[model samples]
Target: MAETNLQVLLRRRPKGAPVPEDFEIVETPVPVPAEGEVLVRHQYLSLDPYMRGRMSEAKSYAKPVALGSVMEGRTAGVVVASKAPGFAPGDSVAGGFGWQRFSCVTPAGLIKVDPQEAPLSANLGVLGMPGLTAWVGLEDIGQPKAGETVVVSAASGAVGQVVGQIAKIRGCKVIGIAGGPEKCRFVEEELGFDACIDHRGDLNAQLDKACPEGIDVYWENVGGPVQAAVFPRLRDFARMVMCGVIAQYNVVEGADSFGGPPGPYLGAVVRKRLRIQGFIVSDHGWPRYPQFRREMLGWMADGRMSWREDVVEGLRNAPEAFIGLLQGRNFGKLVVKID
Candidate 1:
């Protein structure tokens, strides 16, 4: 068992975008598990867009973290000890174990994994949260049909990649919108998107070219300008799943330069009879996780699905990696590898 634990704590709240100094690495003795709990030695830590919302003192569906807590994240780890029944030492597990080298938590929040089946870090990306987010939002809410055009923003990221591939499997003509040519190429070539437009290019023209059929289903992972561009192109009876707003994640806390509320597109929503729904993945559809896991894992095993990870080497680099995530710096899943 590990003798000590190290953690990345929030040193100062970010004003706009985060910087490395906003997090502090601290060392302490490893914790012991309580009843029904196991001690985990974290190996891979997930960096997600949702963490940006947690950094601020703003009100949201999830509670904000206090000023000096270890930054919150979902991680995959190995159980070094267990007081919890059914949890054995050396069991690989996934849970909200935070940004730490060690964790002690109840079995309620942790799920065991078999490493021989897949890469362990994949639990933090393709077969885990990002995968579940994409699957639920697209399959349940978007309900895309065959022969329709399915569009996804942040097209090269973990969630977007899987979402696009799944759409392809369902026979949708898939279009992906990513920030650059490299990412766009990956989406088209590697992930089998029908067309991948560079959002950083002349977005309007590119989108117009890509989705000549109009957008039948839009899996929204980006807000701001991308949303604006997509709005004008939605087809009649289109469906939209609002997942995240990476574009606005970096806007400074208390910045008044932000624009006013959007004008009513009530006419478009009504006339087109579009179905638009915003969802936080965990809260909305986790009850179906078993089904999602079975299907996605099989897809992955059969090489019918693909994924990518932008892994930073150590725990100390998480802040910079997270900062990059808000700015579209990561090409896919962002993970801090601790082991």
Candidate 2:
């Protein structure tokens, strides 16, 4: 076992988009497990858009990452030492282990995973939180019906890919909005979205062409001009599943600038009788997780769903990779492979 634990700490809050200097990487002694605690050695760390919100002091659903503390993140790992029952060395697990190579956690904090069922890294992606987020948001909120148009923004991303595929399964005409031609191609040709518009292009015109019938359900992931374009296209009685807004995450201004004022859309909401509900996945809890896992695994087995990961080679590169993710440079779910 390595003697030292490598960690990425929040050095300072970013005024806007996060930079490398905002994080501090340091080596410290690997933590020892106490009674009822297990020491885990992380293999892969998940980087997500929500972490950007955590990096700021602004109020949100969750607390901010304290200064000088390890940056908050989820990881898939193996147990190296255990003082907890039902957990032994070599057992695969997934949990909020932050951006560190090792963590000492209680059994309740970890979910044991089977390598035979899926790749250990997958527990942090498609079959994990991202998958759950997509499932809950689309099923509970979007409530898509067959032949209805379902549009997903950030279509090539971790949650968006799953959202579009599931919408397809539910018999919706799924259109995706992604950045660049390559990502749009992956969303359409690979993931089977009906069509994908490149946000870098004329978003409004392309959306008009793709969603000519007007959007019945809009799964929002990017909330800037993309949201603006989709908002005006929502059909009567349409449902809008409000998820993340990556485009606004880096705004240096106050919270009012986050989603750009909803005032203009208020008249449309009442006129169209639209349903817009923002959600955080953890709010739904683990009760529905078994249902999500069962349906998602079945979809994967039947070849109805697919996923991709943009993996960074080492822990040291996470900050750069994460910055690239926010800039839309990553083509898929971004994860850091710890070495």
Candidate 3:
């Protein structure tokens, strides 16, 4: 076992988009578990868009990362030492281990992951938080019905990919809005979305042509021009599941800068009788987790669901990979493999 632990600390809060200099990497002694705590040696760390929001001082659903502290993240790893009951060394687990190579956590803070069910990295993606977020947003909020037209922005991303696939299985005609042609093609052919619009093109026109019947369920992920394009097309009584607004995440300016103002859409919201609700997946709590895990695993086993990952090797490359994620450069779920 290594004598030291490598950790990424939030050296500086980002002003707009994050830069490499905003983070600092340092080494320290490996943490020793206390009573009822287990020491974890992380193998893979999940990089997500939500982390950007946490890096800022702005008030959000979650607290901001304190400067000079370890950057927050979810990780999948093996237990190296344990003082907790029912947890033993060599067991695979997933928890909020942050941007570090090792962590000490309690049983409540971590859950065992079965490699036989799926790859260990999957615990941080499709079968994990992102996947659960997709399910809850669509099923609970969107309430998509068979033959309904469902549209998801950022469709090739971690959460968006799962949303689209699940919508398809629910018998909805899924249309995806992605960045490039390659991602659009993958959404259409590989993930089996009904149609995909490349946002770089004429978005309004493409969306109109693809969703001729008007959208019944709109999963909001990117919330700038994409939100503008989709909002006007929602059918009467349409359900809009507000997930994340990655397009506006790095906007240093106020919310008004992103898609102009929400004033223009408020009238339509009332006129269309739209059901728009924003949610933080964690609010749903543990009661629904088993259902999510069971259903997702079954989908994987039946070959109805699939996912992709963009992996960056070494903990040191996390900042670079994360920058790419915010820029829409990553092709799929971005993860860092600790070296």
Candidate 4:
């Protein structure tokens, strides 16, 4: 058993972009699980964009983290001890164990996985939330049809890559919008997106050239100028599934006072009869998880799907890696490997 547990605690709410100073890594004696609980030795931690919202006091679908609490995150780990039914020592599982090296928690919300079937870390990425987020949003909201044009923002990232591939599986023409030439190439060549546009350049011009048919289904991720560009080109009855808005997640607290004219935007929505739906993956995920898991495992095993990881070594590096994730510096699903 591990002697000490290291946790990354949120020192304070962030102002703009988070600095390493905003968090304090503290070491404590690993806890012993009581009844109905399991002790987890964390192996990998998943860092995602939605974590930014948890750092604020702003009202959201869930409560914000209190100052001085462990920073929240999903983790894949092995059960080192268990008082919980159906779980035992050596069981590989994943849970919202926060950003910690070890945790003692109930097995009620944890999931068991077979590391032999897929890399254990995949339980934190493609076979987990990121992949599920893509599947849920695309199938439920996008409801794409064959030959229809589907565009996804942040298309080289975890969820975006899956969104484009699934759209292609359903016979849709998939266009990916990524930050640079390298990511764009990966999206098109490796992931097989029909086209990938560099979001950093003349976005409107590039999107026009890449998606001449106009966007029929947009799995929206980064929503700022990209959404503005996509808005005008949305075909009638198009659907916009709002999965994330990473672009605005770091606008210094209390400095987010700007809303331009809504008339034109609203007018287009009415005229085009566009359907826009904002969702958090958890709600749709649990009920549909069995299907997602069965299908994802097959896709991965058959080599029809692949994913990338930008792994930062050590739990101590999580704070820096996470800040970089918000800045779009990490190339793929960002994870911290803890020994």
Give the Cα RMSD of candidate 4.
1.3
Instruction: Compose the digit string of candidate 2's lDDT tens values, residues 1-339.
Output: 758999999999998889999999999999999999999999999999999999998888899999999999999999999999999999999999899999899988699988988888888889999999999888789999999999999999999999999999999999999999999999999999999999989988898899888999999998988888889999999999999889988889565464546787998889999999999999984679888888888998899999999989999999999999899989888899998
TM-score of each: 0.96, 0.97, 0.97, 0.97
lDDT of 4 by residue, 91-179 (tens): 99998989999999997789999989898888888988999999999888999999999999998898998898889889999999999
Per-residue accuracy of model 1 over 300-326 as CA lDDT, tens digit each: 988889999999888878888898898
lDDT of 2: 0.92
Show where candidate 2 strays beyond 4 Å.
255-261
Clashes (backbone N, CA, C under 3 Å), per candidate, total 1, 0, 0, 0
Worst 10 residues of 1 by lDDT: 255-264
> Between candidates 2 and 4, which one is better according to lDDT?
2
Q: List the residue pairs that clash in candidate 3.
A: none
> Over 4 Å off in model 3, which ranges?
253-255
TM-score of 1: 0.96
Q: Give the worst 10-residue stretch by lDDT in candidate 4.
A: 252-261
lDDT of 3 at 61: 86
TM-score of 4: 0.97
* Regions of model 1 farther than 4 Å from truth: 1-3, 253-258
Residue-level lDDT tens digits of model 3 in 1-339: 757899999999898899999999999999889999999999999999999988999888899999999999999999999999999999999988799999899999688989899999999999889999999888789999989999999999999999999999999999999999999999999999999999999998998899988999999998988988899999999999999889888889465566456787888999999999999999983569888999999999999999998889999999999999999999988899987
Q: Please give the lDDT score at residue 84 for candidate 1.
A: 85
